[model samples]
Target: PVEIGGGDVGVGCDERGCNLVDHHRVGGLERVRAAVASVLDVEVTAATLLTPERWKSLAGSVGSVPVNLAGELVAASGDGTSVVRFPAGTAQVAASDVVDFFSFPGEVGGAGRIDRQRDWWKSWMSAVGSGKPDTNLPALDLDVIHLLGTVAGGRVRVPVGPWTGGEDVPTIDQGRLVDLVVAMFPVPIPQAPGLRPTVRLLNGTGDRSVDSAARQAVLRAGVELVVVGNYRSAGVIQTRVLHRDPADQPAAAALAAALGGGVLHDEFLSPVTDLTVVIGSDFRMDGQ
Candidate 1:
């Protein structure tokens, strides 16, 4: 059996069945289920719910013990089952095991990817707060959950903190939660269209190697490289896409999309090439 502990959320599972112990009843199981499916790459049949006390008792009976979620803990028993125990119930899925317990924070992207995800989440939250329709935001959350779930194998859980109704539910905003989740489990950049854009790559950062790395990334994404050099400035922190003509905006967007983050600028009557990509220090060559 696998035992997981997070804030107030607990999970215990074995090959025969599984259980979830949540202090605050919210809508996270569906997300958990999606994570499981993504990790295991298989359909989940069912799960048996149990009370916290009952789950604790059962866990104890099976040599399970609570541990601090200070960092990350992964344990495997002689039976070949793995259990990931965390204080906040934030554990990734394990690769193998008929029975496993896992939990993860709301945000899952690591290092360089976190900032971009945070910005993306902020944009969406701002739109939502402005009373604009954010139908696609929910899908993005699911996408992140699914991706994290797949990494761990089908057994994952997330604690939604306490629920006191109204504004007392949690001080942290949902956008922040999304940021955390994305930080923990970054999504893959979507592939650019086959109609590749001719790109002029320039390294805005002093790092000379980034230009070469960016070229390979652009090429892997099926984009054509017209020129490679250094930018006029060396202080760019974020990538940017400049199009000389309005007609090439789509091409610039496609190239930017492949790089994951960038601001598209219309240079209008400039005499540059088709598309230009200014690689900044924040440009991630590892992809995530």
Candidate 2:
């Protein structure tokens, strides 16, 4: 929980949008909130389903402080001073460090109520399959975790006391921090038994012969190679695996895992293959 002190911070909205106000003027907290919220959303329904025992366990593990912002608890903080505990670390913030806090709507992060319901059911089924109580679940909301990091000032570089040392303190990488938060929410990908989907390799990185090297690695992993070609966009940076059917997601996920790391997309353009693997500049055959 970040302990906020100093600075008069409040929430306000206008023609532009919601913003953080400090002594009747705009401040940095709104920008910080938007920057973090743009990439994440806290699903309140999923959070609500967590039993008090489960919440306690998750808080102990991740150091999250789940509080209702609309309740009297926030009012008790007194004049924009509050403590917000996030997963990354604890911080002392001023009123200028915080904007208004609110709950996400039923539709957030392109996921609606139905999608959340389906996810909840899937989570329940997974727990039942593993013969574990629902209380043992990991925190499933990435947005909430990211917000915690944001409030904890995980994205920005701040002075760590007086530094009279040899090496300068490294700036925190927001991308890596988000990735760490993502790693906390583990979802079970279903794989089809005895199914080896054909892979169409595309070189998106424009690197010389990188696709050829990747092909060898894929072949070593026993993934079937249907074709090798150049991707439409040469500027693509991250390696990705696209599957034609939802049922083949596990195959795509397996192929991605075997190849080190890759984002999975639900779009297959190839007529002959069930999966399309694009090799980007970030990809290394050695998994570096």
lDDT tens per residue, model 2, 1-288: 111122223454331232222312454544444422332321122222233454344344323222222212123255767643211122221122122221212333443323333332333233323433233334556544444333333222222212121221222344444333333322211122124567788888887668556776565454556677899889878888888788888888888887765746655365678888888777886655
* Cα error, candidate 2, residue 269 (Å): 2.9
| lDDT score at residue 1, model 2, on the 0-100 scale | 13
lDDT values for all models: 0.46, 0.46
| Backbone Cα, N, C clashes tallied per candidate | 32, 7
- Model 1, position 235, has a per-residue lDDT of 86
Please identify model 1 stretches exceeding 4 Å from their true place. 1-196, 268-270
What TM value does model 1 have? 0.32
TM-score of 2: 0.32
Off by over 4 Å in 2: 1-195
